[model samples]
Target: MAGSRRGSRSSKKTADRKDKNSLLGRWLRRLIVAGVVVGLLGALALGTAVYFAERSLPSYSALMNSENGQTIVMRARDGTEIVSLGPSYGEWLYSDEIPQVMKDAMVSVEDRRFYSHIGVDPLGLLRAVWVAVRDDQRAEATSTITQQLARNIFLNSNRTMDRKLREAVLAMALEWKFSKDQILELYLNKVYFGGGAYGIDSASRKFFSHSARQLSTGEAAIIAGLVKAPSRYAPSADVNAAVARANVVLSQMRKYGALRADEAASVDVSAVKLKKESGGNSIRYFTDWALPQLDTLLADSDSREPIQVWTTIDIAKQKSATAAIKANAPKGAQGALVSLDRDGAVLAMVGGTDYVESNYNRAVSAVRQPGSAWKLFVYLAALEAGYTPDDRVVDEPTTIGNWSPHNSGGSYAGEIDVRSAFAYSKNTVAAQLGNDVGFGTVASMARRMGITTPISTYPSMVLGTSEVRVIDMARAFGEISAGGESVEPYGITKVETAKGRVLYRREPQRGHQLVPDYVAAGITDLLQTAVATGTGRAAQIGRPVAGKTGTTNSSKDGWFVGFSSGITTAVWMGRDDAKPVAGLYGGTAPARAFASYMRYAVKDRPVEQFDTDLQLPQWQLEPDDEYFYGDPNDYYFIDEQGNLVEPSGGADNGTKSPFPPERQEQSPADQPRRPSRDNETDDSAPSAASDDFLERAIGGSLENGSTRSNRPQQRSPSSESEMDTGRSWRSNPPEGIIERPD
Candidate 1:
């Protein structure tokens, strides 16, 4: 009975244990099923959000449509293509036709995991997100090759969440629709590689002057590097920046195993050879000169398409001007020439002697002292200050503070008219006039005449001590030719599209009258004297010509600024370093250059005369007592026999004249003259001793033992010291006189 009871309790215990085990198993199954249900719900929610997000995105119909039309062409005034903007769209290249090396370089630099990624790089996107969170939200997006192609083809580059999402969606769509090679073809065909080139075909032609298939690895890397910011890395805009980006691409190419380390290291910027501009090297500088102005004009216009610039450059004239510099410019000396119309149209420019050797456009870039060429402004100021050309200013030695300017000829003219002073380019007179009218006034006048460079208030500024560019000086002289109108020098007359659509039609620049017409006439007349008869004689043409010659101190700079009715031109010649050109003078080389250029430039133009009817104040010639000739009686007269004959107005008539005397000193009606000084011995006539003393003082005495004062007149040591003290301010003249270049 006891064993049966123990077995039943054991059975009950086993059943309870089995029941607990089944309950636990059912709870575990239900928990697993609930967890699966929760996961499905979360996936469904996510899928629904993705579907809606994708539905709102833009369509990708144009994702692969990357065909561009005709290339933009820039024209000169005569409708010749000076420059061509945009690339020639060669036939669309298949992936296989492109150099495999090019493809490797492009892939290495732009998108490394191009083969493995679906469309969007999940790791890259996560990294980009982390970077964005850590940095600013607007950090550069980590776009894949496919994503870039989608964004470039189907959308504008507006960085927003919506755009990014649309870009990702379109990238996936692109990947689904096209093969990897096709996607790459689209990317290559669509990317912008600056200088107005779009896609690999155009970029290859534009930069390397070759087909895309022929691009070397280095060229490929350079072209691939331009896609980031084409304008910034443009070879034309900044070659060094472009080279730096290319090196980065090369480094990436090496890292990605696209190229061997040694191969990558061997590549450099020199490996890429950019195509020469279409207009030929002859007009290259003219195009460069007009580029900045073109940008400004375009900015002001409403056009968005590539433009054709109709410039004032006459190709023939440009050639002639350039040839003139090459033929006439001194060896090792830089030369610049600018020719413009009275309306300030830049007709022709030669910045340097040889553009092939150096592209430093000295015509527009170089700044040097105008030398006497700047005197025009000073005289203009004098005119404005009520001083006339006829007004006589003392040309004698005049000191202001410690600065005493001498004439370039090293001799002073006693008195001279302002016109003569300007013609001769007398430094003392100009400095005096600058002080008279105030240097500030001269600077103001220069500013009005288009000298935009800074002008100092020093007296030396009248001698063109202030540095000025060749173009500005040309424009300043142009103002005078333009009948007192302010100059706004221009190059382009029209800007149009390649298809003949007008973009910017240049209107005439109307300048306000800065100087009265009569005043301009007066200045023109004075400048005419400089060319006609004075220092600028070298610049004389058959007809009326007016200009100034300038040579700076030490012959560092030589300049000639001149004008006719149709054109005003400025020519400058100098060494790149401020070393003196031995024996160089403005009246020599620069004037010759100006004349040579003008002879060809104005051969067809009519000779026109300037209006010289400015009603100016009449000035009288003032006789100066200090500049008088010696006594007329003491002077000799030439007889008909060509013999020197003295007047008979001698003290002793008893000594008969060997040659016949005009009149005897002892006139029969005249009484004996009284002695003027107490040292005189007799009233009849001064003794020989007095005469000898007077002659010795008037004429230089012999350096013999016979002293004027029997012994050297002893002076107090203090007197000698005082004389020495007074001489302190009188410095020795420099080895080369600091004469104005004019």
Candidate 2:
């Protein structure tokens, strides 16, 4: 019985062992199937990522010939290079032409496994990932030379995983298309160094003032170190930082067997030389103004090659204009100047005192009220409407609608000739003329004269209360200088590629006549009278200059727009914020700046005369007119002896004027007579107005109608404030109007 029980228990134990074995076999099969599914999912995810990344890759040709930005070389009219815009590129060097040490240093510092990898280094990536996790930082994948070239040429600096995947795909594509040597050459040629340099050759010349072919070990080390942070490690920026980084590169070179210990030690970090930096020139303003035009001119061209632009700027005149502004612009105030030839080619432009301090181009961009300079358009309208210089105009206080306009000194010369009224800048005369001829006509005249800014139709607009650009003012004056022809200002003359393929060449165009020659002559006649014997006496520069002085209310803006010797120039002075300058006036600084610049500008040019046949009217004091001195108030009057005397009765109570009756009785022969139009060949001749007449007219004595001297001891309040009330009469003559002796 015991034997039979043992046999059955043995049979039951064998069956239990079979059941356990079967269960183990089924679980193993299920685990194997799950592993295959997981592997398929990971492969699908990687393939999907790569497909999206490839879609963003640039074409092969685009990748090979990529220029990150447009390159332009601007030259002056004389063919001298004024400035270069965008990245500066040097000659493309081949892999063989590049020094071996430069290549070695670059590879050792940037990517040690560059040559062995197929664009994306698996082992290096794994090592990088491990290091990142160990240090608790983001993984810096694509840490190879080909990967860097891919990012530099085809991608922006975005640290997202999507961009990283694209970078990796582009790197592999570049490796497949080109040989390793070609990829290395492209990487070196297209990498950006500091100072606008885009190639190793350019970086070498820019930083060391030498070529890449002559690079030494230390120089190569410095250049190689710049790839990490060009602006930070540029030798021109921080020499110590550059040398320290270069030393790290040198140590890597030694570790990679590129240099021996002694060879690396021989590199003298202190002996590194750098190119000297030049001072910032104002030519940048010219480039900034011309770049947009260049884009427009080359709009049809899709070529990415470097361009050579020939502009109309005269470098000598540009330098002179810059110097004049620097010398004449008042402290704490800004100034701008623009010069145009008869055909309206921009010769010289000074946007501010210094281009480095501010790049805001005031000449072409800033719009400010022109003040009395606006009178040019008003008077031009009058001349176009059949009014001659000898025509009559009343200079007394006048009202238009609710606004009343008064002269500068509140003094009125009743029923004066138009020439005298214009010369003295009579506001009432201008307003009456605007009202009579129509302000719309005046605005249209301004547009015909090349003023492109919006015009206001208010009566105050006749007095230059409207805003205009300095360039437009120059262009308007250029119209008169060009013999009544319309003028369009231009800078670029020819545009061509570096390979000499012509893209654009400006054709010589003659502007149509916008005004009658006779009208232009009449306007020039009034301008001549203004400069010769009127408030514009401050602009006399030993030549027959035709210009007007403008001062806004509160002395906010001062301007002088004039033309001489076939050149029209405009000068403006004011605060950028439109705040009042304490003693600033158009006649004081702007007129002087114009004279100073024109003296140099026209020194070599021949003298030109305005074509005018109108005769200036002889101004005479009436018998009932009283000559008041010291602010023209009722309290003071100039006696016959040129003495200030207080009248016994108030000026309103019909007090007999201090005895100036005999002064008016001088015969015509004794009075200074203006030269007749038939005999006046040179408008620069001595003024016909005598010193006594000037003393009475301007409340100041004069010597030769150029210098102020022996003025009355008492001064007018208007004169003391520099006549800031819109070119008012003053005791002292305007500053800086020196007439050269014959």
Candidate 3:
């Protein structure tokens, strides 16, 4: 009976403990539930606050103000764009200006649901999110056209949370401020198309010669495809990539019902009409001529403002010059050309064989040694010293400095006239002239003539050892063409704003007289002989012309700089890296290019005679003086030591005298001008009897129109002892010898 009672009490106690545990568990569960509700409310409140905080507080509102700050205009200089440089090597077009077919293609390929979505597409985002969630990956953008424009215009290409946040915010703001059309238009305008074209207008004109409004379906689609990656899809650079991009656009267009499957398959992007030469690419040449002018006009401080530049570049001339260079330039060789007026108007400029291949302009940017072409200045210096075309000079071997320049034939002949020596391009004779004239005189003449390149006189400097560019060379010739007035090349004729406000006008920089008119005339005459009977024989035309041919020491640089009445042209051919060419010389390569260009340039214009021809007398071969040599094959002169020397130099520098010693004694009182006391060259002035002859000489004045003389060099006594053997006027020429005085 007692055991039964105890069992019943234990059961009662166990039941009471179970009830207590159940009640405590229920109470704890209710408290946890309450805490969870609070945490959920707080998280919701925080997310809402953060979203509202950034949404209303703006960072940038430049959509309108940015356009106000920058302007895009095409200048009149070959109709090239004057705009700020962007991050691509090519151009981009605005969406509205793009052809409908191109626009459809782009939208279809890049974003088919672009028009249907707001800044963010919910469906695309959901699909992306679902796929990412299923695969445990991250979601990128579900961007619409507006969103893309916002990204391109305002945000950088970063995938960071901050950048994405800003882009999303800007995109929303953009949607509020702009309609779909406006956003699409901005996107099209800002996206880059390869090949230096920025807008649809520029690209259409560049690729098809037509306006963007006229782009055909295939053409439009292909151009549109380029926007994704211009260089990758450029036809010239990578036709395969372009075709692939075109196919993708076509496929998207078909999916979007813009084109039928059959039509899309038949579309031949490869067959689309493409020009070999991009339109208005000629503007590239002006990069060298125009950029410097822009900096000068805008003072480099305000170049960002829109400015219209008017230049004298003739599209036709530039095109023709470029074509000639492209057709004739040797493989692996490049060239540049510049045509200017006597007034320094830059009529045409070609900076390279192909600006597409290189932007390093060579016409005005490259510097190369001028070779024998520089002898033109030396010849002018000789004219200043009173030497005439008929003056006898030996074509014998001569050494200037460390370099021993040889004649074209590599052998020396007997004496010849200055005209023939220059005509034949005798390096030895030119070096001898440097010996006669101080090198300083020649450099001064070049500097005065607007040659900005520093001139140094080495023995080979007479043969153009000093380096110079085509523009400087053209300017050097320009000074002669400018009637001895120095002129800086004029590029921008006038500058104006888009609002018709005149900003500035280029006042062509001109210098004081570089050389005496008569002396310049005489040099022009020698250069004329260069075209007529000399190395530049190819340069002769129906009208009077003067020019010089240049070749560097290793035949690396070739040049032909010449002028007539209205046009002065400089042509240069060489390797950009200064590598030697295949047996190329100036007379054959550059001379031909100059001839072709000049012929076509003047073909349409009325025949205009050379300006100086009227000012200078016609050349006439006069009768030889009694003292002149009888032998046609040879001439004689007195050496410094008084040994008889047969004439060696072409005209003036190398006369061979039967009597070794030069006659420096007092001339007959009847002489019009007294010869120099040194008596190295009796060329101060021609005798009165030879007046008509000097008038016919190469130089007309400052020789002051002296008669041409073939007088032998008369050696003086002190020349042997006073000067070093290496610096003697006869046996040894000075290091930087140039022209002697009248």
lDDT of each: 0.73, 0.78, 0.67
Best by TM-score: 1
Q: Is candidate 2 or candidate 3 better by lDDT?
A: 2
Tens digits of per-residue lDDT, candidate 2, 403-482, equal 99977766677765677777778888899889877899999998878787899999999989889999999998889887
What local lDDT does model 3 show for residue 480?
Answer: 83
Q: After superposition, how far is residue 445 of candidate 1 from its true place, in Å?
A: 2.0
Candidate 2 at residue 554, lDDT?
84
Q: Write the per-residue lDDT of candidate 1 for residues 168-229, one digit (tens) a residue.
A: 77777667667798888878887777655777988888777788989887788888889888
lDDT of 2: 0.78
lDDT of 1 at 300: 55
Q: After superposition, how far is residue 569 of candidate 3 from its true place, in Å?
A: 0.4
Which residue pairs show backbone clashes in model 2? Answer: none
TM-score of each: 0.62, 0.55, 0.54
For residues 316-354, write the lDDT of model 3, one tens digit per residue.
777888887777677799989999976888878888887
Top-scoring candidate (lDDT): 2
